[model samples]
Target: MAQQDRAVQTRERIVTGAATAFYRVGYADASIATIAETAGVTKGALYFHFSSKEEIARAVIDEQHRRVFESAAEILQATASPAETMMLMCADLAEWLVSDVVVRAGIRLTTGGAIFDPPTRAPYDDWLATFEDLVGRAVAAGELRQGTDPARLAHFIIPSFTGVQLLSDVLTNMDDLKVRVGELWDVLLAAFAEPTRLDELLALRFRIFGPAS
Candidate 1:
C-alpha cells in the first residue's frame, strides 16, 4: 500500500512537471530529461511513468481538455438567462485560456503545428468533437441560435479564439479581449435571434453587451 501511494505521487509529479515544461518550452522543445529534472526525478523514473515525450505531450493535452470541459460544464449547468449564460460561458472560456498554463500551451501545440504527428492529431480532433457537442447542446437549448451549424461554427470560432488567445498571450491585459468579445457576441446574437425578438433586439443587445450609443 505504501509503495502504491509513492508510485501514485511520482506519477502525479511527473504529470505536473511535464505540463509546466510543455507550457514554458512548447511540445517540440520539451524533453523527458528536462521534465525529469523539473520533477526532481531521474530519466528512468519518467520512463517508468510515461514511455516517451510524445506520450507525455498527449497526457498534457488530455489533462487540459479535461479541465476545460469540467469548467465549461459547470458554467453551462448554472441557472441563468440564455444571453447571460452565453456571455458567462464565453467569458469563462477566455479566462481559462488566458489563465491556465497547460491549457494555453496545449492550445498552441495542437493548433500551431507544434506536434503534427498523426497520433497527436487524433486526440486533438477528439477534443474538438467534444467542444462541438457542447456547443450543439447550447444551441438546441436556445442559448445559441438554432440555425447555427455547431460544427461549422465551432471550426470558425475555435480558430478565431485560438488566434485571439495567441494574441492575448502577448498582451497580458484582458480588457481588450473582454470588450471585443462583447461586441462580437452582440453581432452574433443579432444575426441569430428569432424574428419576433427583432423588435427588442437592439435593447437586448444593450442588456447583454451594454448600450451601443
Candidate 2:
C-alpha cells in the first residue's frame, strides 16, 4: 500500500513538473531532461511512469480536466439557479487559469498545437455541452430572456470566452484574466438575462465574484 501511494505521488509530481516545463517553454522545446529536472525525478523514474512526452502531456490534460470538472460540479450543486451556477463555474475556471500551472500548461498544450490528436480537443467541447445544458435550464426557469435559444447562447458564450482568454494570454499573459472574465459576464448578463432578472443576476455576480475590476 505504501509503495502504491508513493508511486501515485511520484506520478503526480512528474505531471506537475511537466506542466511547469510545458508552460514555460511550451511542449516542443520542453525536453525529457528538463521535465525530469523540474519534477525532481530521475530519467528512469519518469520513463517508468510515462513512455513518452506525448503521453505525459495527455496525462496533464486529463488531470486539468478532472480538476475543472470537479470544481464546476461543486458549484452546480451549491447553486440552485442555473445562471448562477454557470457564472460561478466560469469564475472558478478563470481562477484556475490564474493559479494552476497544470491548467495553464494544459491549455497551452491542447490549444497551442502541441498535440495533434484526439485529446487535443480543448476543454472546449465539454464546456460547450455543459453551458448548453445550463442555458437550457435557465431558459426553462425564466432566468434568461424569453425566446433565447440555449444552443445559440452556449455557442456564442464559449467562443467569446475563448477569445477573451486567448487575448488575455497574448497581451497580459493572463495578468488580468479574472478581470476579463468578469467583464465577459457583464456582457453576457446584458444580452442573456431576462429584463426582470437582470438586476438579480448582476447582484449575484457581485456577491459571488466581487467586481469586474
Candidate 3:
C-alpha cells in the first residue's frame, strides 16, 4: 500500500513539474530533461511514469479538466439559479487560469495544438456541452431573453472566453484575466439577460472583478 502511494505521489510530482515547465516555456520549448529535473526525479523515473512528453501533457490536460469539472459540479449543486451558477463557474475558471499552472498549461496546449500530432479537441467539446447545459437551464427559467439558443450561446462563449484569456496571458501574464472575464460577462449579459434580470446580472460583474481600480 505504501509503495503504491509513493508511486502515485511521484507521478503527481512529475505531472505538476511538467505543467509548470510547459506553462513557462510552452510545449515546443519544454524539454523532458527539464521536466524531470524540475520534478526532482531521474529521467528513468519520469519515463517509467510517462513514456513521452505528449503523454505527460495529456495527463496534465486530464487533471485540468477534472479539477474544473469537479468545481463546477459542486457550484451547480449549491446554487439554485443557473445563471448565477454559470457566472460563478466563469469566475472560478478565470481564477484557476491565473493561479493554477496545470490549468494554464493545459489550456495553452489544448488551444495551441499545432505542436502535437493528432491534436485533441475533447476539452473544448466538453466545456461547450457544460456551458450549453447551463444556458439551457437559464433560458428555461426565463433568466435570458426569449429566442436565446443554448447551443449557439455556448459556442460563442467558449471561444470568446478562450480568446480573452489567451490575450490576457500574452499582454499581461494573466494579470487582467479576471477583469476581462467580468467585462465579457457585462457584454454577454446585456445581450441575453431578461430586462428584469439585467441589473442583478450586471452586479455579478462586481463579485467577479472587484471594485474599479
TM-score of each: 0.73, 0.93, 0.95
Off by over 4 Å in 1: 81-83, 119-151, 170-177, 195-213
lDDT accuracy of residue 146 in candidate 1: 65
Q: Give the TM-score of candidate 3.
A: 0.95
Ranking by TM-score: 3, 2, 1
TM-score preference between candidates 2 and 3, better one: 3
Those runs of model 2 whose alpha carbons end farther than 4 Å from true positions after fitting are none
Predictions in order: lDDT: 0.67, 0.88, 0.88
Angstrom error at residue 205, model 1: 8.2
The C-alpha local distance difference test score for the whole of candidate 3 amounts to 0.88
Q: Pick the candidate with the highest TM-score.
A: 3
lDDT (Cα, tens digit) per residue for candidate 1, span 102-162 = 7766666666654556645654465467557766765666666667787886676556655
Model 2, residue 125: distance off in Å is 2.1
Model 3 C-alpha lDDT per residue in residues 47-132, reported as the tens digit of each score = 99999999999999899888988988898899458888888888899988988888888888887878777887888898899999
